[model samples]
Target: MLTMKNVTKVFRTEMVETHALRELTLEVKSGEFVAVTGPSGSGKTTFLNIAGLLDDFTGGEYRLDGVEVRQLGDRARSKLRNEKIGFVFQSFNLIPDLNLFDNVDVPLRYRGFTRGERRQRIERALERVGLASRIRHFPAELSGGQQQRVAIARAIAGDPKLLLADEPTGNLDSQMAREVMQLLEELNAGGTVVVIVTHDPEIAARAQRNVHIVDGVASHLDRGPALVSPALRTA
Candidate 1:
């Protein structure tokens, strides 16, 4: 679960000041799939960065899974982020030279997992993303969709409590995007909380809940029962 209260982020320069987020209060519960949609400059990325601990807010409180993120030191924040959160990015962020297996192995290596343990995690994660047989393939050799799946695999290898994706399907074709969305849905159904930042209405519509960001705050949120429409789940 995630909670934010009066979150504010400001960017300052010698001559100009910009407020990226202003008292943006948002919450995502366990097992929830949330889509954060907004126009450019609406602070969607700022919110995602703050939520994922990549950046600190200028003011307000943010708690992730009951831990106060705003108060933690950098080292502690890094540890918490690695342990509790997974990330998927728009650009796939894969190491160009590493094979699929090694790419997924990178994060687990930081955790001090032995070769056997890392191997197992990588295998399972790849299988979950439907990329088991392509473990030896390089990113350049795979299709865009396969590359994105590999990114998802890398994120899930740690068995994170929360998954944060930014423009996850932005580079893929419609069919590939749909497939990726379906995979995300499946992951959410299995109890991993997911929050995505997207501009596509169709992509946002697939999430169990939608939050529209405007002027550095959550402009709209549907507080209806946590109900996922049936159609969003199908391939």
Candidate 2:
């Protein structure tokens, strides 16, 4: 679970002060899939970074998986992040030269897993994303959807408690987006807490909850699934 209370993030320069998040309060429970929708510069990215422990908040409190994260040192935070959080970015963030297996193996390497264990985890992650056979292909050799699936594989290889995705389907076509969404749905069903920041309302409808952010504040929209598909219902 994740919780943020009255969280404020300020980016101050010599010339001006920019408030990326103002009194932002949100909570994501275990096994929940939440979609974050916001306009440009509405602080969705900042919230994601803070929630993923990629950045620190200037004020308020945040707890992740029962640990208070307000003032942890960089080393401690990085350790916790690597242990508890996974991230998928819009850009895919894959190394073009590294094959699929190697790309997914990168994070496991940092965890100090042996070659055998790393291979095991890599295989499982890719299989979950339906990309096991493409493990030897480079990023450039794959379609956008395949590359994103590899990115998701890389994120889930650690078995993270929380998965944070930013614009996961931004680059894919409708069918590919649905495929990626289905993969995420399956992951959530298996109990990995998922948070996605996206601009597409239709995609947002697939999640359990939709949160709209504006002017650095977030409000949860009390509505049912955008469509009553069986997958969305169970997810």
Local distance difference test values of all predictions, in order: 0.90, 0.90
In candidate 1, position 74 carries an lDDT of: 86
Q: Which regions in candidate 1 have their CA more than 4 angstroms from the true location?
A: 223-234
Every model's TM-score: 0.94, 0.94
The candidate 1 region of ten consecutive residues with least summed lDDT is 223-232
Q: What is the clash count for each candidate, in the order shown?
A: 0, 0
- lDDT string for model 1 (43-141, tens) is 999999999999989999999999999889988898888888999999999999999999999878877789999999999999999999999999999
What candidate 2 gets wrong by more than 4 Å, as runs, is: 224-235
Q: Supply the global lDDT for candidate 1.
A: 0.90
After superposition on all C-alphas, the RMSD of every candidate to the true structure, in Å, is 2.6, 2.2
